[model samples]
Every structure is written in structure tokens, then in C-alpha cells.
Target: MVARERERGFERFITFVDAIVAIAITLLVLPLVELTAELDDYGSVSGLLRENQAEIWAFLLSFAVIARLWFVQHDAVEHVVAHDKRVERLLLLWALTIVFLPFPTSLVAEAPEEPATKLLYIGSMVLSTMLLTHIDLLLVRHPELTDGNGDADPVDGAANVAMLVLALLITLLVPATHYFPLLLLLAADPVARAWHRLRGGGSRSAREGD
Candidate 1:
């Protein structure tokens, strides 16, 4: 009975997290909606889209990022059989970062040309990723928190942290290269795998979470 109740409680927590993530994802598109009001002013719809291409790209980029973050969070939760209060707190913190994303996302949409706005948007993503990494670390350190359903992979966390750190450095060192840091995010997994191989430890299946 106790085990069943614990699982039920964990399910509720996961549901709540999912709801928050869904809301956050929905919020990501809100900034783009305002662009519709000014559509006729651009002479044509296509022209308006073209004129606001930066915002469009920002929206798409942020959407993709948030979607990926949600995936990571959902995947992590699936491994959890029972929850610790610390893990719950970390999950809430992670959700807070996810919710905060839209604010920076809007800043990017409003001032896509500004270095500060771009940095802020990327910085927000980096923070979100870091929080997720911390959660993964906690899981790894406290395997008792999970139900043996999945193995926690810390390499994944390391790769993400490395990627974001490098991205931040590039943004700082090369302000002219707008949005280039985003490319690192896409490369994170491959880079992480290679890192594991070079280290001569950790099986491929394990590194890839297979």
C-alpha cells in the first residue's frame, strides 16, 4: 500500500510538472502573436514575415529549445520511481527557469538586434540547462531516489554544461556573431559521445543512454 501510494504521489508530481511545461511552451508563442496586428502595415503578409524574420527566427529557436528542455525533463522523470523532497525542489526550480524563459524570449523578439537581448535569451537557456544538469546530478548521487527503471547519465549533463559554457564564452568574445552560439546546443550530444570515447571509459550504449 505504501509503495502504491508513493508511486501515485510521484505521478501527481509528474503531471504537475507536465502541466507547467505545457503552459511554458504555450507562452513561448505569445510574443509572435502581436506581430499579426501589424501585418497589413508591411504591405503584404509575406513582407511582414520577412521584415520580422529576426523575431520569427527567435520564436522558432526558442520554441525548439523549450521543446528540447521539456523532453529532457520528461525523460528524466520517467526514470524516477519515487521522489525525494530535494528532487521535488529541484524540479520546481527547473520549472521556474522554464517559466522565466518567455521573458527573455520576448526580449529577443523585441530587440533581436541588441547584443544584450541576445545574451539574455541565451543566458536564460543556459541557466535552464544548468538546472536540469543539477537535477541529473542529484539523481546520480542518490540512486535511491529512482526505482531502478533507468540509469542516470551524468555525461549528458556534463556535455550540456560544457556546451552552454562555450556558447556563453563565444557570445561574450564575439558579439558580432549573433545566434551562432545556438549551434553548440545542437552539437552537444555528439560532442558528449566523443568525449566519452576519448576518455576510454563508459560504453557507447551507456553514453548514448541506449
Candidate 2:
């Protein structure tokens, strides 16, 4: 009972953290000036949206990507048991990054045409990936956090590594790609997830036979 209570407390804390991330994601959609009554031009408003289509696309894309990343992070953390101060300390960094990510997401949308802006955006993603790597390293260092002693899903580990590589490659294109490659990630996600699931099932079946 006491153990469950302690878990409840920690789970509540994580929930709060997740809430902050959601709000941060929502906050990225801003500075949309309303069309005034004097400027009752629907055409003008539509034209404005069209002119800033890249920014709008960036906003939507970043929102989706960031939300997906947060969902993954939350799922990973839920299954993980920090085991020691080192692992616990890394969660603090993770939360910090969660808060900081919005700045880059918002910036990317606002300046999609500018190369520097894209670089800044991709830099944030790279930092997120690095932090994600550090989290995985912690999990590796403390194998107790995983089921079947971290060897159960070597394929999943490989998929994550591949995804990290893909992200790093995409990052290189940055503002020069003008969010083209970033948009392409939308297509890659489903395919990668499906491949990962297939590999996981294969690993499980092999383990069962053993």
C-alpha cells in the first residue's frame, strides 16, 4: 500500500510535468493579429494566411512533432525506474528541455524562410535528441529500469539509434531546406513505427522459442 502511495505521488508529479509540456506546445501558436472591423476584408485575411503559409505549416508541423516526442518521453519515463540519483537528475534536464522546446518551435514557424531560423530550430531538435540519448544511456547503465534486463528489445534500441541518425541527417538541411525535410518526417513516422513493431514482434517470438 505504501509503495502504491509513493507511486501515486510520483505519477502525479509526472502528470504535472506533462501538463506543462502540453501548454508549452499550445503557446507556440501565437501573435495572430485579428482582422479589425475597419479592415473587414475576408480576402485580406485569407491572403495574409496564404502569405504566411510557411509559418502556419511550421507551427502545425512543430506542434505535431513536439507533441509526439513528448508522448514518447512520457511513455519511456513511465516504464523506467530511475534507480539512483544519476538517473533521477537526468529527468530534471528532460523537464527543462520540455519547457525550453517551445521557443525553438515558435521561432521555426515565425521564420521558416530564413536559414538561420531553421538552424536554430534543428539545433533545438538535436539537443532534444542528445538529451534523449543521455536518457537511454541512463537506462543502459541501470538495466533494472527495463524488463527482461534490457536485452529483450535490442531491435527497438536499434530502431531508436536509426531514428536518431535520421534526425541528425535531417537537421543538417535546416533553414536551407526551408522546412521541407522536417515536413517529410511526417511521412517517415508511421513507416518507422510499423517497422519497429514488426521487429519487436519477431524478437518476442524468438525469445519465447528460446
Candidate 3:
């Protein structure tokens, strides 16, 4: 009976996390939706697009960021058969970052040139990514919380966190860069794979051969 209850609790926790992520992603579009109200000011739909390109870009970027974060979180917990208080608290804090993302996203759209806005937007991302990294590390430390599917590789999360920190630093040092540094995140996966190989953690086939 206790096992059954724990299973149900895990299911409920996962469902709640999914719901929160969905809501946060949906909120990213609300600002764009409100743009429709100013249709008259722009004179035409194309004009509106031209004038509000920054807002549109910000929405798209954040949507992608949140989606990627959700995927990372999902992968981290895919093998989790149970949860503990620490995991629960970390997940809630991660969710809080997701929910707060839209606020800084809006700020970026309104003041793209402000260092403070850049800090707020990218800083939120750093915090979220850091939380995931911590969770992955926690799972590595406490294998009992997960099924014996496979070992967790926290290198990916750590690599991402590093890339984001680099991006944040670039933005701060070069204010004119204007979010371009974020492109560095695209290299995170490759960097992680390289690091893993360097650590003698090769592909499954290589390990099997060994």
C-alpha cells in the first residue's frame, strides 16, 4: 500500500510540473496577442510586424528556451521512480523560474538596450539551468530515487550552465552584443559529448566492447 501511494504521488508531481510548464509557455504568447490591439496604430499587419519585431523575437527565443529547459527536466526525471524532499523543493524552485520568465522577457522587449534587462532575462535562465544541473547531480548522488535503467550523466547540464554563464558574461562586458552571445548555447551539447569522451566515458558500443 505504501508503494502504491508513492507511485501515485510521483505521478501527481510529474503531472503538476508538466501543467506548470505548459502554462508558462502559453504565457509567452500573451504579449504578442495583445499586439493585435494596436493594429490601427501600425496602419497594417505588415507594419505591425516590422515595428514589433523585437517583441516577436523575444517571444520566440523564450519559447524555445523554456521548451528546451522542459526537455532537460523531463530527461533528468525520466528514470525517477520516486522523489524526496530535496528533489521536490528543487523542482518547485525551477518552476518558479519558468513562471517568472515572462516578466523579464517583456522587460527585454521594452528595453533591449538596458544592461539590467539583459541581466534579468539571462540571469533567470542561468538560475533555471543551474537548478536542473543540481537536480541531475542529486540524482547521480542518490541512485535509489531512480530505477536502474542507466546512470545519469550530469555533464550535459553542467555544460549548458557553463555556456549560459559565458553568455551572461559576454552580454555584460559587451553591452552592444545584444543577446547575440546566447548563440553560444548551441555548442553546449557538443562540448558535453567531448568532455564525456575525454573522461573515458565513450559511447555505449565502445563500453560494451571494453
Candidate 4:
């Protein structure tokens, strides 16, 4: 009975977290929706879209970011059969970052050149990724909380954190770069694979496969 209750509680917690993430992602598009109110000021729909391209780009970028983060969080907790206070706290904090993302995303649309805007936008992502990495580490350390799947890997999360940190640095240091530095995230998987190999995880997996 106790075990079942614990699982139920964890399920409720995951559901709550998923709801928050959904709301946050939905919020990312609100700014773009508001852009419709100004359609009368522009010559045509194309003109309005052209003028507000920054807003559209910001919305799309943040939507992708939040989606990716959600996926990572889901993977991290997929096998978790129980939750501890630490995991709960970390997840809540991570959700807070997701909730805060839209504000900075708007700032980016309004003033993409401002170092402060870049810092706020990218900084939120950095913090979010860091929290995720921490959660992954926690899962790795506490396998008993999971189904003994042994599939929790922190390398991908760590690589994502590293890339986002690099992206933040590049954007802050090179104002001309704008948000282009975010493309670094595309390399995260390759970096994770390399890191995993360096740690002999790949070799062990291959040996097991053989």
C-alpha cells in the first residue's frame, strides 16, 4: 500500500510538472498573438510579419528550447519510481526557470542587441540546463529511486549545459553575433558521445553488446 501510494504521489508530481511546462510553452506564443492587434498599423499581413520578425523568431526559439528541456526532464525522470525531496525541489526550481523564460524572450524581441537582454534570455536557458544536469546527476546517484534501468546518463545533460554556457558567453562577448551562438546546442549530442567514450561508457556498452 505504501509503495503504491508513493508511486501515485510521484505520478501526481510529474503531472503537475508537465502542466506547468505546457503553460510555459503556451505563454511563449502570447507575445506573437498580441502582434495581431497592430495589424491595422501596417500595410499588409506581410508587412506586420516583416516588422515583427524578431518577435516571431524569439517565440519560435523559446518554444524549441522549452520543448527540448521538457524532453530532457522527461527522460531524466522516466524511470523514477519514487521521488525524494531533492528531486522535487530541483524540478520545481527548473519549472520556475521555464515560467520565467517568456519574459526574457520578449526582451530579446524588443532589444536583441542589448547585452542585458542576451544575458537574461540565454542566462535563463543556462540555468535551466544546469538544473537539468543536476537532476540527471541525482538520478545517477540514486538508482534505487528508479526501476534499476541503469539508463540514466548525465553526459548529454552536461554537454547541453556546456554548450549553453558557451552560447551565453559568445552572445555576451560578441553583440554582433546575436542569438546565432545558440546553434552550438546542435553539437551537444556529438559532444556527449565523445565524452561518454572518453569515460569508457561506450566501450563498456559495446563489450556488453558483444
Best by the lDDT measure: 3
| Candidate 3 vs. true structure, TM-score | 0.92
- TM-scores of the candidates are 0.88, 0.66, 0.92, 0.92
Question: Candidate 3 — which residues are off by over 4 angstroms?
Answer: 1-6, 203-210
Per-candidate clashes come to 0, 0, 0, 0
List the lowest-lDDT window of 10 residues for candidate 2: 1-10
User: Model 4: residues >4 Å from true position, as ranges?
Assistant: 1-6, 203-210
How much is the lDDT of residue 118 in candidate 2? 55
Any runs in candidate 1 off by more than 4 Å, and if so which? 1-6, 113-115, 203-210
The true-versus-predicted C-alpha distance at residue 109 of model 2, in Å, is 3.4
Error in Å for residue 20 of model 1: 1.2
Ranking by lDDT: 3, 4, 1, 2
Clashing residue pairs, candidate 1?
A: none
